[model samples]
Target: MESSAPPSPELRLDNLRSLKVLGKGGMGTVFLVHDALADPSARSPFALKVLDKSSINSHHTNLDADRRARWEIQVLARLCHPFLPSLLGTVESDQLLGWAVPYCPGGDLHVLLHRQVDRVFSPPVIRFYLAEILCALDHLHSIGIAYRDLKPENVLIQQSGHVTLTDFDLSHKLKPKSIRTAISSAPAQDNFPETRSKNRRNLTRWFPAASENKKGLKKAKSARVSPVSRRKLSFSNGEKSNSFVGTEEYVAPEVVRGDGHEFAVDWWALGILAYEMLYGTTPFKGSNRKETFRNVLLKTPEFIGKRTVLTDLIERLLEKDPTKRLGYVRGACEIREHEFFRGVRWDLLTEVVRPPFIPPREDGGDLTASGKDIADYLCSLKSPPPFPASPSSEYQRNVSYGEF
Candidate 1:
């Protein structure tokens, strides 16, 4: 729904020095790059995701990958949230297309999870991270975007110890459904009450049934394919996506069943992410991918000890029925009001001076004294002059979305 173009940048690929390869995925390779033109005495670094046109356009169907790449750039351009990355600049060469965003010195949530003594976060820490993530999702949903992938790997810890979400290639925009239609479409609400007492009663009866034996479960093998597709499946708001997308462990039951899914699928994945953060593993992961999907559709999440508010929240989020999920009707407002987040000061999240962890900043002491040679190299290039002098002119002459 946001049509404004992102501000252009003064930095260019020639002005950046490749530091290291951060990651490789279906969309592109992410590189840790430093501003070559910046004072070498200071570390001016960022992340660059580069897509090789030849690699993406090799096959006819794979052309969709290019579209997804451009779509991600568009998504980043529109975002202005504290927990989301800002699109800094873009590069288009003969074969390579790339974009840049501020780098999070701290690693992703997956890396942080393993660093924990028990490989799981404490309740307080979980509450802190979830609150920020909720705000980010609320912003995304408000703008008609649904982040299909919500795994820990996509949540990068910022230098300030807070978290910022990354990797938007799997995201898609949908029209926001009116409150009445959004609420009425959910069949699970037909007999359900919003009161906590009734909600608890429903959850207690919905816990996994131990009576159902898992020993007799059969495993089925299927052709291996990328789990989350980059194909755009819908163009309107309130429409359902039939495309098979999302990680196996985090995919919603509706997604696994190939039933139409909307924003509710994100709430389901958020539940999966919370479960993994608290338990060190996903709730319904099976021995094989097929079994995992089956479990997603049928099995209920199991808890190790007595029921607690955190588990209660997970249950509400992991509800097999999307319509019955906690955020199904009210978006993030429902999750934010859950008992688990009772003490969170949502308004003061960004002000927290010290979070659970802050990444160690790499000193630029290793650079050559004065670094005059690098500065000279930056002056030698003939790349297009930074961006236009004014915002209005930049917006008018900016590269088209498809061209990027």
Candidate 2:
């Protein structure tokens, strides 16, 4: 029997009052909105992502962006995992295309990272966040979707301190490989063997006492390429995507080389995320985009402190060769087994009543009179601000609406 499509969005724009601007981007603006008709004491508010269809069509030459907008809706419709967002409904009109999902009051991982005293998370905190993120990604990959974009901004904290991944525009669906094929075939590589040290520099032996110059010089040599660069290709599951997509810092080496990428690319991003949570910045970041790409292609991540299993996990995930990267063959299973997550009780994550950080409930208010006043005040702006393009905007990922 043919599967029926999910129900259309029942949310009415007129009944929804904008409480605050959450984010805006090329695709559209996300608003923290409340349903005026709902119970005054009930927490019926949600985040509404409104896409100006006309604006998107005008800005981009192709319909790829439009398709991406819809792709997110489709991906959310069937997702029921605790660590993933649920699509409440969608809205469409002559000029707009939008959808609503449960509002996450805890904000995103980026904001949480900055909240730390040193702008970095301790190992325990990193392990907590990464474990939830790993579960979320495992669920995504199981559904045959490759989340091309996996950055701090995309991981939202829930009321309980658990995480829910958002922004699915860059995600891609593929035909899943059969268990037989997956078990029999070795992971593919881009002309590079699992052990890339033979062709590149051998930095595994370098301890904390190693000279900095030697490490830097060797890293610089590994990144040098011929005049010609690898060509980009489109991607599909079990197949490769050639599209040049993803956040620059979080993008995998294969993505930069235009060498087609898959689920493993997300693992590479995970490595970067771990590094940033520990160090307050991406490991391969450079002064400029060009330099950054060069660093990603050739540089080995330098650890400031001593060697630990956490650093080891990052090294394995950041392997320049995708085929050799952690999680390449067994996916999240391989990562979950790493020493870094030695004692994580994966099945009981959601039941943890006291997580590392639980968002304040006051931040998520019901339909109070004050909330109404703020909505009216916001609507009364001389030039009502265009919907906020956040996580989507180049520099607005960190922006948040506190109280209003």
Candidate 3:
């Protein structure tokens, strides 16, 4: 993937202006752009995301590259939600280099989380954010689209605390036949032949061994001399290869096992995020990639203290058995109704109510200054009293198993 190209002075299109850089990624760059057609006095702003032409042009045989972009545009155009970034318009210039999308000023949830890791949100506040995400997921799923990517970075939070889901580049439109094929595929492997046996061992940790008798003694005996001794087992003989996808820390077991994942995968990632927010760290982290993956496969996450309704909810969400996972059997409605969300009224969450925590502001009293000042102040709290000469290295490493 290529980084987004710097704004081109010669390629300006109609109704688009002032290309201020928002962020850059391997695929493209997002900019804070203005809509020339909108009322100049209007208070709202939009973000224009430009996909790198190099990436789009590099894929010679796959029409999917083009199709994915078009699909995202169509999906965004059809969706109308308080928690979704509205698509003002899309354009392909005469130069034929790139595609552009609207700008979102609220920034992303990942940025906010890093700035306020020390702050603990109230239960209602957490529920409010989670409910909004669920609502967005429901809408996407209803329209036959699966948001393959769901991370704090992909979620945007406005100054008003209203969160909007963005980044449809990785989303896929679900076709009935394809869905059937995915469901019918087999478990995935750990890449190395030596690790194949290790992967199978880990699988048994999460799921019960297939045996006629329920007794543990019988299962232990069966494991020693089972007829099916091969480490790698394919789910479907002719199914397509499993593509490496998703952030490593947030990827689901089903996805890792190559058992054909679905919308429920998003719920698993949400569980990880919720845990991180509550504890100030991820539950399954390790020093290296292999160690982290092994932890995800075999180890159980530790809960800090007294069991609360929220702890129960987190346990359900992080259940190792995909069949018993929070979103799998119970669905989103049931999740929203869990005791942890006791007093939440989903209908009123989008009405510009104040959020639980507001990042501190500067004495200058400018809204723009508030966000930056707060970020700066948070950095100042670090012990040892040192600021890095360069950007943090945390974002440089790959955290997900998925290939970009």
Candidate 4:
């Protein structure tokens, strides 16, 4: 937690210029913006999430929207990691509240995946992306935060082509039971003795990560990915969330059951994500939401071919029971050492200068030319900002869990 984005002078909506809408989601609009005064030539630009004050407060329940906006800003202000966004500045006006972070020009993982020949990533590429994502999630967890949202859309690619996570409005701060509890919750240490014996060779017969037979991961171009939600779901031990939240396709079984959940929900979502990346579709996605939840709770993920290390990793991660999930007991430390990443040098992730994709440079060439006032432009939108009643925030809608 140190400041990485160069500090910007105080900014006001009046002085900012909106160049493009990066995305539209349940919370607000993310834009590519520049400070007209700070970067007069607009040589440097950032991503800004703007929320309309009036629209956010329209319905009583919209208070949740307001709280999440502020919460995201607070989280960004406190983060300083290569795979995480750092707050550049903020704007609070009578009509709007906005904050800025580094603009990731390389687009999102979803867009990158579609750019691939089979709309999926190879095993090695998946490993590269997941490793960075794992680090980002681990960093957030280190500070007691549970990231309920873990989808490709939230994974942004920097100009350098490396990934960084965005949209923290759905994240929750958690409290572990105790130092002793954190250390003692090893998933299978008693049964798996690879760390201390020659049995390591046989471990893969029992567990492995993912494998690839599709076209190799290829270079991709920049594209935008919108934000989504996830529930922290644990109401017990002061360490779980009872709230039902998250994209239906990636929601965990406990979340569907409304049973208390904790950090394990994220690992479940990771399983869903890995499955999608490997096969180009989610495992539990049925014709409808009810069917999907039923599949999540009852159906096993169908594999296309013989099991590989990658498939094994997904299997362990996708365990329907959160308590039995691979990462449940030890968090990311457990997953990082899976057979798929046996020889990886984790420390040098950020040092890689080139990745599978690199975004085209902007350098104010188009920025200075666009002078649309951000505040006025946002105020002119025919639709309102993300409020409690907006169609965009589907996670907030009443879910018929009984249908499953």
Which candidate wins on lDDT? 4
lDDT of 4 by residue, 1-404 (tens): 23443444357777898876767787788787887877777778888888877666467647777898888877777776778888888888877788888987777776666665666666766776777787787777766778898987788888767788988988877785343123211122123223433322221222223333342323222221212234544444448777677889899898887776778888888888887787777888888989999999999998765567778889999998887888777778788778876665565555444455566665566556766798788778757433222111111111121111
The sequence of per-residue lDDT tens digits that candidate 3 reaches over residues 1-404 is 11232332232455544333455554445544544455232234455555544334556523555555655666666656666765666656422223444443445666555544353333334555676777787666555556768877777765455677887867655532232212201111122133333333211122122221222211011110000122243433222224446777777776666666566676777787776655556667778767777777777877755556656777788887666788664346657667666555454444423443333221212222222211122233232222122222222111111111
Please report, as a residue range, the 10-residue window in candidate 2 with the lowest summed lDDT.
218-227
Score each candidate by Cα lDDT. 0.68, 0.69, 0.51, 0.70
Clashes of each: 1, 13, 14, 10
Q: Which predicted model would earn the best TM-score?
A: 4
Q: What TM-score would every model get versus the actual structure?
A: 0.76, 0.77, 0.65, 0.79
Q: Model 4, 387: alpha-carbon shift in Å?
A: 17
Local distance difference test, candidate 3: 0.51
Judged by whole-model lDDT over C-alpha atoms, candidate 4 comes out at 0.70
Reference-based TM-score, model 2: 0.77
In the range 1-404, model 2's lDDT, one tens digit per residue, is 01344765677656676666676665667777777777344366788887665554455433666677788888888666778888998877666677899987777888677665566765666777788888788877777778888998889887767788999888877555443123211121222233533333111111112132233311111121111245644443366666677888998999888887778888999999998887788888888889999999999998875577878899999999998999887888889778777766564555554456667665345335444432234334434455322332122222121100
Clash pairs (backbone) in predicted model 4: 209-309, 209-310, 210-309, 210-310, 233-241, 233-261, 234-240, 234-241, 234-261, 235-240
lDDT of 4 at 222: 27
Quote model 4's TM-score: 0.79
